[model samples]
Target chain A: MPFEVYTFRSSGKRLFAGKNTPHFHAVYGIIAHKQTIMQDIQTEMRNRAKELLESKQAGLVVGFTLDEYGKPTPAFITDPDDVGRLVWNDDCVRSRHNLVGCLKRDEVRKLGKPAVVVNAAGKRAFNVLIAESQREPGDVVLIDMEPEPRDARFDERYAKLAMLDTMSREERFAFWKKEFTRCFKCYACRQVCPLCYCTQCIVDKNRPQRIDTSATLKGNFAWNITRAFHLAGRCVGCGACSAACPAGIDLDLLNLSLARAGETHFDGYRAGENPDTLPIIGTFSVEDKETFIR
Target chain B: MPQIITRQQLLALIDSLLEAGTKVATPVARGEKAFFQYLEKGDAPLIDPAVFPVNSTKEFFFPRHEILYTFERQGTEVLVTDARPFVAPQVVLGARPCDAAALPLMDRVFGWDFQDRFYQSRRENTTVVSLACAAPDAGCFCTSVDLSPETQAGADAELLPIDDDTFEVRVFTEKGRILFGGKTSESDKTGRTGAAPDRKFDAAQIRERLQTAFETPAFFSEAAVRCLGCGACTYVCPTCHCFDMVDEGSVDKGRKVKNWDSCQFALFTHHASGHNPRHDQGERQRQRVLHKFSIYPEKFGVLLCTGCGNCVRGCVDGLGIRPVLEEIAK
Candidate 1:
């Protein structure tokens, strides 16, 4: 058989020939311009990281950069010269769960102070860290990310939670059971979670195993429900579990459902907010009223 | 005999399979994507040739967790009972060619020294009816792995969609003939075959490059630094067959179960003496690449990847195998 051939219009030639095709030029031109702006943001972020490291304001700066595959990923910058590796884009959300765990490390404490690059969502996790007395506000530098165009897909999942709620009990049960069957008990959801930073998880305790470690349907359900319950009043809705799940399970629904229920019943107390405010789960008052309890 | 079946007939075929006490599994469309699932009797099968199911059909053969045996302590004597595997006949309808091909590649490992009864039994009972992909994505590289959308490496039958409502079925085995009930018509055969897609990389070259690639620790570290040590890639993979065995239940009464495990996890290689040969993420990542491209190919004369692109698509970060292989080629 002869090798099938495809007509070639290389990117370089396309750029030059794009004038002949106005449609291609317009689309490609906008994309190229957007990329340039993104690169500028990344360059500025690197400069900021370098300044923080040089000024001794932060012994270590946690940032993100594109890897060899051009995938945005988290990076811990200690040397000023390495700051050029930092990047900022749509995919540059830092897992605050990792930062929370890092702050507790003895080596990190020995380094004097840590600065972290975070978006508005990540700042909520910092509030939880402060409220839990994990770190003092002054002990760390918080580089708040500028608001960019938000991806509506995540918010769309929250809306899908409503769709899930509309399902009958049997339908919901069947849906969750089918979803849980794909879970391999990888603990990636727990690993990626900023709030699930326990040195030893409950599932690891074999003496009186609270949840089975096997990836059986029953075991998966138990693991998922327990993990969700553990973060009921504290999950910052980072959507890390959903992103990390290889099975494409929308675990954000479970967390968002709890968050919605908490908001409705507990005077709209949100997790990852001002740490000074008493937590809904921990606080009790005679004024606390709920119709769902009855 | 090759035959043509309308989309409606395909659904009816699935219905008939279920009616005959056969478990027919296929990719089921949810909203935006599809998942491999068991189609109940009268349920419609959503075989989207464009979309690869999130979970592979590997679970149909080798389950995530299975009981090997159960033990009970009675009066000082321990009573052990071997759990028998269920060996019901099944059909996998409209599986991706890449996923179908993984079955035979995995067979080498499962059947090498000692035959895995559970996997073997499932393999023996199930007939794979793979659907050739109409459109391969940037992540898809079945051609690079010495397989293609129409390779039929592990399939008993192949279905080529000629249009939105029609498919040309090609039988490869007696099992496929049995499933179709010898109702095929030679006159209806289209004589059409799947077009060859663009090759992502050369398999021979990748295997050769993988030999000395392990020496470059700096390259591996740079490639794997973003890895969160997650099992998403492995779990979704059609060929990854690593398993961990653990006993569950009370100390007196328990069942030894095998669960899916991944080398990406730190605990997968952790030794009791606190020594791990694959200690860092980079080393672990290197092992994974080596296992698929070098070690498996050296032993089995076949690459351990079917190039379904699940590892690339399922990765939490954009840590893709295609790009990693490209780096090795460089």
Candidate 2:
């Protein structure tokens, strides 16, 4: 009842329309529609995870669940009984590749248990591990994800990128300058990213301090550009970095712009599509499709 | 003296401050979350403080990045020029009470050895106008730390929204009195205050349990297992003041900048020879709690936390301090 003040409007009317009203019914209908879709996917995911955990097929099932704050967070369920805790929602936008990437470490590998996720990110991360010689194909188990609509929560992410694309060079500069001003160098983007799995991140090294950790205008520009450039062709486009950022920086745009450039210049070299495909920068082709290069 | 001011009068005060070349920071909605940013001249600030902002008012005081000094090579001579702290007079309007209370706790650390002029100057320059929180979130535990919605610890002035259009302004300091500036009219409702939410957690019980917490490694380890070791919790925290000084730009021509640092990171304690006293996640987690509850209270007689719950809200894994405190109390 303490939160009732939040619902009460300035005129003392409830913020939301009355439950019996058409407006309320319509809103409830939309919510119910979305919930039904979510429930369908979640039930299947939970059942599969439960089966895997119970059958000893996987040691852990990396999934999503609501935290105490009602925010979706990564859940590591080892017990079949705990599979009920797993959920599927728009907030679970993180690419599970990073979770799987942890298994490659010797400390985590010693646990001797496999992990499963119903997504492309986990599979893509596993492929990157294989590409890096950390693991071979079939070393990890990835269940085929159900047909879910592309998360619309990231529409603003793409829209911002599009808006930046339309802006003049000076306008673009000013836009990014304002955005980068919010950067705190928390490294949440790098930490959440599956591909940014360097044992010693360049920002962390101080002997030759590669990138400034301070979130100053010059320092942020340097650090952000370096981070985006590093993942040019390799980024999985999972939207994890932008999703995890507490600053709300539109980093997805940076990655997406680079991803588009990689696709255009490298003859549609989409990252995380095929495990065997040579990385755009990793291999040189005699029949390279760089006719635009003067 | 406590005074009454209409919502329009408050808005006009903010407008006048902006017109008079004073930087006014407020919680402005950007994208999905509201962050504390300096309001532009025309922008109307949000009246509801919304419990707490995504980013604390700490940014106005101790910025995430600050240039300490710049060095330039002038043909065999290195020229150094100190970067003075920006001390322009400013106002933080509609600051959450919990966030306002954190300023004094930060003042203790920044003023301890070498008086950090950057933090001290901002503290002196900025006048905080805090709005009493009407709706406390699930994660809020300000009452546990001896702070309430009406607790005016660090705020220059406090305002309680009586209804949609009026606010009861209570000036605590000379800075606040000057900011109000005779605009507030005398009204019958002078000393009236907002209703505070029920106490969320038992602070005394938690404090007692923490005294003997160090001996119990198992308790901390259990909590540490879920931690992703991300700096989200500390960076969003109101009182986490640890920082790292590094030279940005080239050795020939660049600046020495101080960046906010968190103990949650492995590198926070890593030495040149690869020796870390707080190696494990459990130890690191223990240090954070102990510092907030034990060390801070022992030194400053105030808990280091303001219970703003930004850490809880922004935590990547949802590792809230309330549950941890509850566990310790148990």
True contacts kept of each: 0.50, 0.56
Q: Which candidate is the best by TM-score?
A: 2
**DockQ per candidate:** 0.30, 0.40
Model 1 Cα lDDT, one tens digit per residue, A97-171? 234333443334455677777664566676776666665666667665533314345346368687787899999
Residue B94, candidate 2: C-alpha displacement in angstroms: 1.4
Kindly list the per-residue Cα lDDT of model 2 for residues B260-307, writing each as its tens digit.
998888899999999988777667788888899888898888899888
Q: How does the DockQ of candidate 1 come out? A: 0.30
Residue-level lDDT for A3 in candidate 1: 13
Error of 2 at A230 (Å): 0.9
lDDT of 1 by residue, B219-325 (tens): 57655555666677888889999998888888799999988889887778877687888877778788888999999988999899988888877675656577677
| Candidate 1: pairs in clash | A97-A194
Candidate 1 vs. true structure, TM-score: 0.80
User: What would the per-residue lDDT of candidate 2 be over residues A253-289, giving only the tens digit for each residue?
Assistant: 8988887778767776767655676787766676866
* A8 Cα displacement, candidate 2 (Å): 44
Each prediction's whole-model lDDT (CA):
0.74, 0.74
Model 2 segments more than 4 A misplaced: A1-44, A89-112, A147-160, A284-294, B73-77, B190-199, B215-219
